[model samples]
Target: MQPKDWQKDFPVAEPQPFTQPHELPGPYGPPLIGHLLQISSEQSHLTLERWAERYGSLFQIRLGRSRLVVVSDHKVIQRILEQRPQSFRRNCVIEDRFSEIGINGLFTAEGEDWRRQRRTVVAALSRTRLASFFPRLKATTARLQRRWEGAADGNQLVDVCRDLTRFTVDVTMQLAFGVDPNTLETPGPVIQRHLEKIGPGLQRRFFTLFPYWRLIRLPPDRALDRAVKALDREVEVIIRATREHMAAHPGHGPTNFLEAMLMIAEHEGSNLTSADLLAHTSQLLLAGEDTTAYTMSWIVHYFTRFPEAFARIRREVDDLIAPAAALDKLEQANHLPFLDAFCNEVMRLKPVAPHMALETLEDTEILGCLMPKGTKLFVLLRYAATREEHFAGGDCFDPERWLPQPAGHGNQPHNTQAFVPFGAGPRICPGQHLAMLEIRAVLAMLCRNFDLRPVSHGKEVKEKMAVVMRPDHLHLRLKRRSLASSVPTCAPTAMAASRSGASHDL
Candidate 1:
């Protein structure tokens, strides 16, 4: 079945004559350094959102020498994203940083190179491939359930972010390389440790005024160097093992993402290289791990804060997939409308990629703003998504808004064009299907097996941006459901439980 066309229901804005981006309103920054001193790299997204509120949706800001056009207007952002490689390309700094450590891939490639890399990634993560890979995903999730059950049995405080990261890493490794790192069960020098160091380090370099690490390597810089080398070596071993596996089982089609890419490279000689393969393989682990994990973490946070929504989702999971430990078939996941809406709500509030940075490939007009070639564009992805003008009760976490409203609701201004969590148009994330599947499976499993409680010790869960936005110091305490309570309940059982006053677990 085809996915829903979210944008089709919303009204499209008409294009008009252009205006210079520099002519837009913005706050003042210091000389030469611009906003470098004003905004720190970690909380830059928050600063941009505040600035968007003070200034209009479209404005300009200077970060060091680069004067950037900051766009929070979703319509304009969609237009800019849709015109990719041709009119806009990913910011050069992103590619530079990724290449500096030898892991640049589809995320940073441009033009024909990007197109070629995109084809391999798209095919590898295609629906047909993901369907076949469902059993592996289910197996990984079952491992997670077992781990969480142990934690629940011990009444241990679960490090939600760390565990979720491990979960994604394991899933990505198996799905991409057909190897189960099993970070969920075993403890060792995992790739997640290195990734933790790299993401924030890259963010630091991206916002820094100068390349200070080149002249002098600080402790963190030295650590980053080690992490990069370690990750490269790790991926090298996996690549060699994968090649050996393919050699042994020669004639069959690609079983995993790495094999698929290797096949493409072998067939289309000179089109892809060894460096390209390594970079893209490493990129999948990098790209897949953090975003999905963090989003799931945020979902857990939301569940703790909004108990009613949590209970409602648990009810939905029980209605659909209860009596089973986890989702058995891929089609079973498609029946989860409320869980789907709940995730949409979470992503809308706390988008993992809160903003996207791109550079103008040529002179372009966005929302009537004249953007010169090489102009830096910082698209505030979550700003317009949470605004009252776009969504009703936009600040509140209301999953029902995503579900179809009743007929008498009289068409609330739910501007679907303003929402691009996985982005829009040609260069949208290729791994979105896999990401959503992981999210639904894990969330459903959590709701079905455990009751979630927040472990924040009087400190509010705050957003921290290290290339991706994630909650800081967030943790959860999981309570395993009794076999009787965990069973799929018919209407009479549910009503009886409701009447007995034993339905307050959320």
Candidate 2:
């Protein structure tokens, strides 16, 4: 059978109410697989938004034999994620796969394990630590600049997604394992192939809810097993080298994140095991690389689509590093208001993780709705971000929405909960600060060095949901912009600039 054919075999049912009429807003699902078919199809986010329009913000859908509550309302999401964290836990099916591989990292772990891991990560990724890592961030951005310059030298229409992926992978590898994957100069096929495979595997596991699938497990694919072994062996080598170095120089250690984890492992006096260290390090590599890279791709895509935003970003960069020779001043050049707003706007529209899943640990009442224990919940983050009620010009890419206004000014109400690109609640992404720093630095450099425009023949990039939200086949043409020109040649036309103030352009 073809991969998606099984979806057709599942029985579909009519929508029913899972809770009282006045409690939650929408109709529930049918017996087995309710609205699962509708949601699992292509561009599910848009489909969910349409459903939200029909059935209210909070609704229910059935996936195979499982029931899932879809929450798009900001108040309900905040309450569930923050006010009642104990009532919700990471989805078991998703967590179990990671636990099986000795990876009880924060993303997959639960309860005390999750809390400890989060605390450790938060300490390592705090604002102070991120500031300390600026030198490394600058170095990676420099490498990407060189690559972009070379690519544009031949006037080639390059895949910005591919370039961003390589750059992010290189930066993440260095930060996590202190090993340069050389994805920029020489891409590592082993790492790239395995990273791609992991996402599909995860998605398949997420879709399969029956316990029998795990019980009647078939033999593992030999090629995939071999790739896993190779990756594990590489990680082991790095761990061993780090241990040997720490022992030889005791107290004098590397300044990178991996070394910091090692120090924590020692200080914890047996609570932090070797497996824990390896798992956290690997998690960092996985989470850090693709998410940020995809975000940068979307940022570039938006800039191309809305050239006024691009021009604003370029102007910000130019002002920060005038004379175009202030390479050393890059670290101190992050105060650009428009650049910050632009990044926030991109995140608002194209959140890297579009859907976040949580499972109920106990029966609970949310906004007067009684939810049964074991019911899975998927917060439709992207849909919430695009709703007209939350954003003034819902579909348009407007950076000005994030700008701070004068006190008591009756502008559009700013709703941060509706824009959860890095997530909300105590379980929010710990690496958020580091990720933002990396994105801001790379985007700042790109805007300064080159003029980004969409490829004439390439299709307009739209959201493609994987482990991260990425642009599907985002091909962009780069024109090398000269700092010598007082008026940037690639600045948007007057009409294009004015359109950003309009509603629903996206």
Candidate 3:
């Protein structure tokens, strides 16, 4: 069904106020465990989506001893999301787990604290600021291209996820702190090694019914502790170095997020502390890496499945940026409408964050069901995105739906609200602008310089849950384009270091 036709069948309904919480529709599960075992699997979002199909838009599902109100309705979810920090906040368990690992910053903060920290973060990643950081980002992309070039030349299989992680780590470290740990070229005891352990550890604890790690230190738990301590030591060194730079220059202004945050904390009458700065810094580092890396990885996965889209992007990139190997200007990244549309489709199909967990701060009535205070709500972001009721052939990977059509064409409108990949409303991911720029730069560069061929079979590729959803065991082979120019041979280490001091001229 087309989007215009599906809306007539499924209209966004107003609250009925007649239904109660216990009266909602759901599946019957085993006595004590409820749906814990099935939902605790790595593909929990898929499980919730399947249940959404069976039980209608809204349903109640119990995981272990706790009952959660699962919602797949986008309109309802939007209404609830807009009331954040006041009417609803992130589930306390999420904050508790993140706080335990020392990463509970802007992502998990609430009320006034969230407001203050968000200002600093928004300033750091703002589009104006991102433009100034483009040279560093471009240099990082050039390094990744070099890595792929070597792989293509040797006919070696490229671990797409691992390489993309390195790309993001290199880009993020420079932006987060004014330092370059170019993991793409140098492979040693860097920040990426420690960051790799943090995501899985957090995910393991999030789904576990009880906090067993606190009582007994398992191998993984001990490793997590060591990773945290090591990461803290690294961050402490960065803080000391930044302070010394500031003291020596005296005339120089804050250059990076860490510097900006440190300056804020040092300001008189500011409420933020050293611990708060550390948490927010770690938050940006982790937040910047996985989402964008997994997104590009999924784009590559789709390119292998749909070669026509790959050709289309390559043609677009070739026309737009032919002489240059990769995008040089920040504005050039914005001009590729087709590449942007293609990314929109990829995100719609495989959102890194498929669901967002929140808790009600006050008793609320949604649709017809009354949710009491402290009730857990699972908003299925990807569920409604794939439903035919909101999109035309929603399950399929089609990019044209996101593009503009002639007026007389069958009116297949795109519902932007239904697809909340980065989430919606005030607390939406602040890094979205940065993520999109990074995606455009890297993918455009890939299409321009190489052809992606899948190394793993379709069935062999799995979606494993970590800090965010990622393509597990995904491998690809890149063949350098014959007609395309050779990849840039600039030394990224020097480029990054020279540009490190040249931050956004805010």
Candidate 4:
């Protein structure tokens, strides 16, 4: 997909006049480093949930010297989202980190650049063009299905997160760069190991809460550097190769993102240099992979904990899809009402990016409070979804709440705003549709082929907020439906070759 010609014309908005804010209500911590030491980064969202109950939907919290205005109020989030690329922009820390990485994609870029980048990505993965990419998605899924079959055969305790990570990484590479690195079957788990470092590294830097990240060369930081550099280096080579390939084969362009961005760059919005292409592509790879992978893992975590939910999903799959049917027509996933509600429920319970930080680009009044410019805003996405005002039984896990009521039920309109799994705003995740497609396809296929039984590890599961919200464990056993009843079988392990300097096809 490519950017539309009109997106290039979007104009930057002027800053609004400042209005003095009344003394904001908050539990101000000690001089400077306010609530920084009190909350664990891993369970920060739960802490915010507790605070939301005590301090109301809107209150301030201290994390180091920073005074973060946390908003769990839906109306405030609505106001913030409604005013975008003008009164509100992503936090400077986010932009600076993207800059440090030498790339600014849709997420980090602001003003006209953000609009242009957003158009490029959305078009690339748009519904109109998604069909062409389905084969690549199916290929990777088949490999994952087979690998899981192997694990079930060995009675191995599969790490659902690790396997899902591999599946997403492969699909991302195939769709984003037209490359295939069959990670699921690859020995040594080359790409898996590298992608694993990224989330922990980014989370470490976020929690460090200082400007000396480049100077500190500790394991987490160093590992981050290595992982980022490795990914950047690979993307760069792909970009250059893509450029050469396009030059040699004029009028017949490449299929993935590098080609799409390059083709659109010459004639469209925000004149993108080679550097812009590299940065944008790299950022997509870095950001896209972690969030989708973690979200899928969280879905698994919920299903494992609640057997009834998994059973319902399996029944739905059995009813809708063929017993051993290949999940080829992904568009048909739309017809799956129960599965869709199931996904909605899982995300409501466990959103991957629980907190997204933005800054007040201008003095803005939200929910009757005037927040001045430069105010650090923490959009507590998860908390917003959990507020009693936003959702009934905010803490409970219920998929039926998302579904339409039966014929006998009273008429009560559902509060759609309660679910903000993908955040809200001009910068709300552009990749959400594609993410859901991948999750649904894999999930539909998994439930149809096998029965996933939770394996208790004695310890309760923990939410480790590493960049993305990740479950500390995915202890589940896969029982093949075929062996018990009647059936069939279905691949990227490419980072090793890249590490060894092996070139792959476009």
Candidate 5:
């Protein structure tokens, strides 16, 4: 359908009070529009938390003409995500915007199509495959270290998030397309621009008082359309290059993820056309890049905020690689207790994907409340994570909360349902393991090399939720640490040293 006709078909509905008997009540707005304008403009999770406290955990808010059910109860979210995958698909706004640039990959695909794509992508991102890809990850980390060194020397206040985004984008591009776009050194192509643009656009659509069909047609800006076209063109180029390479070489090179997909197409005697390839590649890039980078950035932010935790991590890195001169010893740094706790705490406090939207496929009852088919549900993950009832000192940035108590000690796994940073269910993030590895490795190196402090007024850095929960601006003053002071005098393993090259020295 053409964009205009599509808009007409999905006409904006007049807002009304939620009619369902089981729906929890929320503050309503004027006729034909609901609480959407209020909810979207303010912090959503905070708004939902307040409503839950007032009404209950499963409250209804009118999103345009649509009724959205927001749920923070762990049991309810788990059941919806795990037991009712079919009943809950991607929310309408996400599905529509992502589709514009051909994003029907595992993350957004549904039913049998989702299952097939997920199976192939998951297999490729499996533990064994990730281990093989470690060398590439390590290489990228090395390059990042060089970048950091240059920044430190120039006394630049680096936006750690942007740098990490570039690094992950580079890695995802290499892993998925076998082509290094080198976005780390330069601004990304049109697709990259769209990747950034589409996120805020989707967020706006989600919160808008009008349906997306109406919103997109009204000419505020054609930036979104332009971005979509740019993304499409970039993906098209990659698809064409892959096809040419396969036709010319035909079974000559080691099979990568793209090659594996192509092989499946060839064996099935199906022409897995360029569009399919473009869509899947776009999916892979979107899935792999933003979440990982955001997670890494959050970890750094938390480390800087909680200096004790930061100091402990630095000490752990030092102990793991006793000899400051031996970079190989850094491998042992991965096993440090404090480092693990710090990363977990960072995820708990600032989950990268704080809110996930799911749609109900059929009538279902959650927590004794009946939800009709096609209901939109917002899974409030970060609010769940930080609830006072979920953790002792829940609002405090304490890494020790994640650590195990000594044999006779008191701390046990705090039973909480709010900690689902990666989401829950059969459709949980497939790239989680790889993401953890990247985060842990990069964070380990960062602590070992730099004495990082937030900018003088940086303590006020508030998080603004976009596609990910990211700090609006993270300005860190990095002082390169002396190797001898940071690490012990012990000899390190060759691998660790090679990875933490002289670039670490400011």
Candidate 6:
């Protein structure tokens, strides 16, 4: 009601004179809908961007009686991110809905339950394992490339989003757990359909009329139940298969993520149950597959929007990774400047999802305002990345902003404190290292062998959000790139000065 009133409603350890949490400006929208329709699942980030412009970033909106405070300021985001398991927890409304379906994995678990499971995950997905995992990643991307090559031969349009989805699912399953769920090879991919269902269903969970939709026998509720059942069936089978394989190969040192986790579970005694194993496997599969896929799709989407940028990226891939030297031969290019910058730019512009919802563990102070326990806090990731204050030409596709600055240049580039595509702080994504390699592999292979020709060239493609955000109308054909372009055209500059190339000029 007043600038000072919300602080009294939400007392914290220490509070300063600031606007009441509720008094923070926002388009509250209708009482029931609460901007739900305005920011529909089809383009939530776009709507949020519009609101962020209107409300000046720090604002609040209601979602089914839950007061959601959206933070686009990088410093505020930094504050919330630092308060991981102790002060802020995963959003209960979304996480609880997942738990109800018996999928309470690391993403949902809080307190020590989260910490313990997270340690296991980190250990399983360690960097050493990625060397062994790289072959699988390359194999999966190569397989998808062959399929696209076939499509290019016949003048067929490729569903880049779906293919990337299949590719990531194939890679994620094998690399994470050493199973071949081969959605890429399957004609009518059952698991892929189930995986696709989850994003939309998860969206429904966050923005529906009633928060407790499982209590209601609505269409969305029934479909979500069916989707979970199908997903459970598929994932549990893989868990059983992994268990059997581990048993068969006794005394084997941990090879992939599953084996590493199994070893931990065995040595750690009875703390890790079979159900916990199954739940973690499900979480890994679901989280790993879609997030990587759609982010890559958005990368492709950016390339389509800016052809010259795409040409420069393709040139970088061609010269650097040409003839695609064996994974074992791959070197210190982990810091491949241009490639890294391109991926970074894509994530900044189009993050895996628009926002990550966190719930407060205790009464916490955000931006000097008290937020009582159970407050719904949204890290407006897309907004922060696109804000004029945080970035120069934030809406423009400029990867150079991520490149290292040239020597003797007395200039500060854009602020990147808001760049948390894989998240930050202690609870940052465990699979992030592996995900980067996977992304590099896909980007290199696809760009080297083919030119992405958008089917609807020059038309605006909107984002479809669920658990992951993807292009709603993206279709491209992989027309083979000539060997001439594959050959080094210009001596590549240090990526710092590479901005002299046409990235900004275009």
Please report the candidate that would top lDDT against the real structure. 1
Off by over 4 Å in 5: 1-23, 187-194, 211-221, 252-254, 322-334, 407-413, 456-459, 489-506
- What does the lDDT come to for candidate 3? 0.80
Determine which window of 10 residues in candidate 4 has minimal summed lDDT.
496-505
- lDDT of each residue in 159-183, candidate 4, tens digit only: 8888888888888877887777778
* lDDT of candidates 1 onward, in order: 0.82, 0.67, 0.80, 0.71, 0.68, 0.72
Off by over 4 Å in 1: 1-19, 271-273, 491-506
- List the lowest-lDDT window of 10 residues for candidate 5: 497-506
Superposed by TM-score, candidate 5 places the C-alpha of residue 69 at a distance from the truth, in angstroms, of 1.2
List of clashing residue pairs for candidate 4: 103-279, 142-490, 143-491, 181-492, 181-493, 182-492, 182-493, 183-492, 183-493, 184-492
TM-scores of the candidates are 0.92, 0.83, 0.90, 0.87, 0.86, 0.88
* Top-TM-score structure, candidate number: 1
**Quality of model 6 by C-alpha lDDT:** 0.72
Cα deviation at 26, candidate 5, in Å, is 1.7
Instruction: Report the C-alpha lDDT of model 2 over 1-506, residue by residue, as the tens digit.
Output: 11112112322232342353234454455667655656653356666667777877667666777666776766667666773357788778777766555545668877777776676667766777666666776877888788778878988778776788777777777765667777666743646555655554445456543534446544433343454556566677888888887888887854666787788768876577777777777767777777888888888888887887787777766666654522344344446667777877888888878777887777665443456677688777777777777787787887877665556644575566577787778887777767777777788778777877677464656776665667887887777778687343443322212112211111
Model 3 steric clash pairs: none
Off by over 4 Å in 3: 1-18, 269-273, 457-459, 484-506
lDDT of 6 by residue, 355-396 (tens): 778877777666566677777887777777776666777688
Q: What is the overall TM-score of model 6 with all chains considered together?
A: 0.88
